[model samples]
Target: MSSIANTDEPAAATAQGHGHSASTLTLAVGAVGVVFGDIGTSPLYAFRETFAAHHGAIGITPDAEHIHGVLSLVFWSMMMVVTVKYVLTIMRADNKGEGGSLALLALIRRASDNRRWTAPLILLGVFATALFYGDSMITPAISVLSATEGLQYIVPGFKPWIVPTAVAILFGLFAIQSRGSGKVGKLFGPIMLTYFGMLATLGVMHLSANPAIILETINPINALRFFQADGFTAFIALGSVVLAVTGAEALYADMGHFGRKPIGLSWLTFVFPALMLNYMGQGAMILSASSPAAAAALVKDPFFLMIPDLVRVPVIILALLATIIASQAVISGAFSLTQQAIQLGFIPRMEIRHTSASAAGQIYIPTINWGLMVMVILLVLFFQSSTNLAAAYGIAVTGAMFIDTLLLAAVLFSLWRWPVWKALPLVAAFLIVDVAYFGANLIKVPQGGWVPLLIGFVIFTLLTTWSRGRELMRASMSESALPIEIFAKSAQNSATRVAGTAVFMASTNTGVPSALLHNIKHNKVLHERILILTVAVQDVPYLESIERYSCKDLGNGFYRVTIRCGFLEETDVPALLRTLDLCGAPFDMMHTSFFLSRQTLLASAKPGMAIWREKLFAWMLRNAASAMEFFRLPTNRVVELGSQVEI
Candidate 1:
């Protein structure tokens, strides 16, 4: 379940749509800049935090054995969790070339014919999405703060400036969302390319001095020896170790932009090696410290200290830039994910604006953007430092990863039809890692870990409540509706026929909208031509232009039209109608008067969801964005008709 290209690339087409030549290389470079940001920036804090003295009493001396052990675990987690699980296996479980939790859920719904397991699968997918929201909030806080925390090493008296500086940078980042990321995205590739080059360069400098550390880290025996060396301490260390693989899921989520090959190329050939080299370099630097005091200081900030003193300041500057980019990617992912959730009917409609006219996928959501800003800022202020925030960061990510493994199991068995023998081993390996990381993170719930779980719980409730409420409202409204044939014959001669076209928007395709019935009752007149329109969202990303709209004549100048929209697409009704050729007359926004139904929900004693949820649904419905603006209808021509409905 993965990527809605939260990118503003006017010229970017998915790599699967291009040749694997120069263009493919370009996509891979772009992937390095955006797709790998989260994981790429992990070196700034992940390795150092694993052996921090402040991480309770679990951490031990960062000596030869522990350094090899930690590096071994980091290397293997990257290989298995990122390379094997996400890049190799789960990336293949795409929905029309799109990947993400909601995208995967849509794929499963479209692929499965068996109805029994669908309900729980839907719940799993929704919970995964909820966890993603939590991850998005934490990623920015931890990433930026960790990088800026490097200031103390650069300028010893700069400790107080770190928080204020991070806060300023974050505020500026969120403030720029409405302007679009096209120019910013074009710069991402170069900045990250430079950033990763530095990481590899610093790593190679240390590894050249000590090739033995490299040899010791590559063997799985070191990881095993680590567990055998400190059993319970090593297990608790996993909560920190998992921070290395935090953004692996983003690779799959972002697959629709660059395709599997480009993302794989970026990771395997470039991003992956750079990350491993940096982690190993940190280990080598820690093990080679000239003094015990130096060793202790290096262990606290291995990534920054690994660089030579002369180059440390520049590297710190680059790390800050990279972290900013990482935070931007996570924020964009949240916007894209929210758009999918709205289209899939899991969330109430909000104000969504296209930031780029050329790329439909690049969007800005005011509500989600501002909401995330508030939460992220609160997290940074509350946690006060990246070390404290680390306890909160991994739970959401690990929980989402475990849920993805479950969804992948479903995809393998049901969609791919993989034999049990092949699928079992893969699923089992993924489960071992996911369950271990998730269980380890559970140990942190009492220590700042409750933040993400609390966020996930609230989000999950809102999602389910909205989905179920929509169903109940539709059922209630459908029970009181009149069919087209019945309404048409009855209204034919009952009122004066006017000259303009009347377009009534309907939520359900089979019945007359309450707006039309209310219109006739109040106005005592009808337009010469009446159009019953319904915009339907299908479980796909993009639909063909020719199959955009279908209109069927209901006789007597009445027609029922349905607009087919893909989940990853926009619903611009008037713009779409301009291209539509109906039998009687061409669609003109100026000539058409759009009538919209605004439902006022009441929490009835009727058998439905709980009374509290019904009231919550009522509030959501009332606060939802206007259908006219959401569908891109003409501002002056739209009229709203209100009706109260009980569920």
Candidate 2:
């Protein structure tokens, strides 16, 4: 509200395809590759783990009723969660063509100017983001492990080699991230297309053997009957049933990458049909088994068993490739989320490397990539099998989904202004399903569900600490900040005028920068033409070049310039300055000196945060990337003025 402009108009325009030029078919293909990858690979372990005897929750029998019931549950879960809630509903809530918790938070804040609700909404958004880190780490581990576990179906001896093989594959995946995904990204669409086709073909072959399974699965009565018969056990199965829709968040998270229509079309035309057929076919195969013992064995790895013996090796190879693609989606999403966090002031700025020449969203964060690799390898080594990892999976996803329902309620009530009767019933239905899944996963905490929750808590603490600490630090600095008019008059009377132009970076537009005061007090000199510049990150993804900078003349050879950047765009101060012809003088690199303030934070017995948190925030601030690199300032002509601040 100080220097930040309203991003609603620009964000809405971008969401409407203002910047994108891709054809509907092309974007749809891309969506299938990236947006659908996580959910696409769930067939590997969702059904198997649901009835695993080790869990002792849901028991699998060879009877048609049991098989049909599970199939119906999976089918309807996808329809309600993925198709209805996400694809059709949440996708429509895009913030200027962007999705995910943070983007949605910004949209909600902009929609309602209610100061009382702002902080609580921000906390919800931050926690949702924290849970996403858990999802990101678990996704790659489980996806790769499950895909490689297919080796047990081919050679029994390969059982011993699964973990090692997955580790090697994961290391390779993380290693190639620095080079970016542009080259390999093109192959993703075609490879995933082939993978989906194979899924349909295998399912079709099995469905032919027992055509009646499809009819039984299509009916809603089986799901109702299963719940009624199994009671508590069926409720427990909801945790595992949620696996089928594990990557449902990706649909909304990645809406900015591919448009809404493309994602919806891809799901409706190809991905949805392929997944439904395969799941139903697995049910049919188990139901039509020769005996109960045989069916029990097949359910352990139903996805691999669905293929013919002769072609199992080829299919397994295809599955492995598909899983790699799936892992890539979340890894890329992690990088995008971190960038958003930094721009939104929830985290410290980190080094961001643009990987693609044409695509602005394509970026690589070295710290995040290596950190994820280490965590993923540790998980694979610890869990050893996808079955073990499955226990840790659903909690993060369900937690995030539950939070999403809350945010969507805000969107319905405040943003969309939907009628009370219409919104209440729809939101209530979604909350019932979301709460059921979340509660079932909560039961798994004693077993392995604690992993994600623990990770989320740590991350949530770090995020909130940094955010609050920054606010306190800003307040402390603002208390001593001199008004620009007073500082300008003092400088004009007391300081010696130098030969070149000086740009002092200010945190807020209303105050004279600390660096300028320090330079004048110590050096006793100032440049002939002085400028106070403040860089404000807008709540949008990208800003137009013409709307990038606003200049105000403050009199006496002084000007106040505020540069606005979208979260997704690069913040190069010099480049933006050079393009401003209306700022009186053309920017010259050789004649400019940039002044910056480097604050040495002292964590006092402050009331703003706990002592432990203040220390953590201080450590983070010390290790944050330098402003010169982050703002693309020239190193040769820059001067850093150090100051001590207690917060």
Candidate 3:
């Protein structure tokens, strides 16, 4: 019942699993691969758009002061928002060192004392999750497009071929997923390492030309001036610019994989400074240039423009590698989100296969992987340019950020048991920052924000429907299960004598299984002893063996056994039973027959969904991998009884 028992010690206690702690440097490097990939590559297109896009173009002063000021805003925004707000403060709010929107939701849900607001809390989470799907699609499009567009910087004639070539490269990227990313991941760290070195070198070279940019970063006056100049305009530009820091969330989401210390250190020491210097460098480049032709020099390739032409080829290659790494991070995030959704019961269980044997968390969900790949490919093909894809990117990332702030408030007030006086200020500050970004992103809806908004709404509806429908189904099944006390008395007296154990899988510990009801209705008999074994999959991902199962003996030798499994773990009944003490419970193999209940969904003339959705749901149910196979139960011992249900 304790929170620690539910979280920390399950698989390790059972398998003698030992976790190896990564050294500080190794963790920092690895964190770059996992956490900062998306945002790391943002410099490729973020600033270029500012000079060329609507807001930037409207007030295109093309001066060093405003460019310095704009870059100053970016530098400090990363420092204040990404590094300070998230890496320093929010990362510490990790759910057992596992970060992400879900982890934050779970922790807050568990900790909150008030039940009244639970509904809205869950809705907020569902919306955030919905938004992420949009983020997933846009990340690949923008990353690949931006990198591939850089080719034109070197070869102007290649401009006509950029879109088609980018599409082809993305197709190949998605095509190779089944082979897994073990080798690709190995190269990710080294490539990002080179990319960071180039970033630092670019910054150093540009800063030597105009050291005054360093003074702007330190002064904070430029940031104030930039904001005060056109507060409303600056606020609107932030919606898109925030995309540059979207991967800030990954710092926390990936905390479990790389640990908090590494992410914290990387943000403060290497990533933050490199990002600031480069932005400032870009600002300086924009400042000195004259004319759109010369501005073309700065805008054509902001990421590589600071470097000499001799080294541009190598920078271009590194940019490609960084984008690949970024896409991989988003793909991994999609897997983690699906896993959490399954455990939380917002979605049905899917085939979750572990991609890496040694890492418990490195899983691959074929459903999500293929779904994202299709969407990503379509997005790249349609958008053709990073500028177009950028329009659709921010709603989901910022929406999720806003939800995190709300969840954090709940944590402070109820879960952490902080006083109202102390919680109010912290909550207020985050809300102001997060809500501004959320509002800024809202301005983008007509432009391209509608994509994520539509995705979010559709996903929210599905999640709500599934959660409601599952609850109703469970209630109906529970109502149908016979009370164990009455069944035990009758079975022992009147049923046929069986020499072995008869294990009926019950949905509840206090009742006979529905499969047994079907069996008795058809055959007019029940097995001797009638072991009513019930299984409860907990909300959390792991449970201890000692806490794995519990038994209650009904009268006349009918025993009710309940087994617990984490969300990430598959149910293996035989393996679970082997670990049980059984408490002198009789179990002869010849007599033991495992009974399972399989729901056969029926389409009704009565109103629920339209004919199309019913047919779609039916197809989904039929194509779904069998539950028996999913649980890894033995075919011979398992006997399934089908029942009809209308949803």
Q: Which pairs clash in the backbone of model 2? A: 11-96
Off by over 4 Å in 1: 1-22, 53-55, 291-293
> Could you tell me which 10 consecutive residues in candidate 1 have the lowest summed lDDT?
1-10
Candidate 1: residue pairs that collide: 1-100, 1-101, 2-99, 2-100, 2-253, 3-99, 3-253
Q: Which is the better candidate, 2 or 3, if ranked by lDDT?
A: 2
Which whole-number lDDT from 0 to 100 does residue 364 have in model 1?
A: 91
* Deviation of model 1 at 524, angstroms: 1.5
User: Which candidate should be chosen as best, given TM-score against the real structure?
Assistant: 2
lDDT: worst 10-residue window of model 3: 1-10
lDDT of 1 at 496: 88
Q: What tens digits encode model 3's per-residue C-alpha lDDT throughout 14-41?
A: 4211233869899899887778889888
**All candidates' lDDT scores?**
0.86, 0.87, 0.72
Q: Which stretches of candidate 2 lie over 4 Å from their true place?
A: 1-18, 54-58
- C-alpha TM-score for every candidate: 0.96, 0.97, 0.90
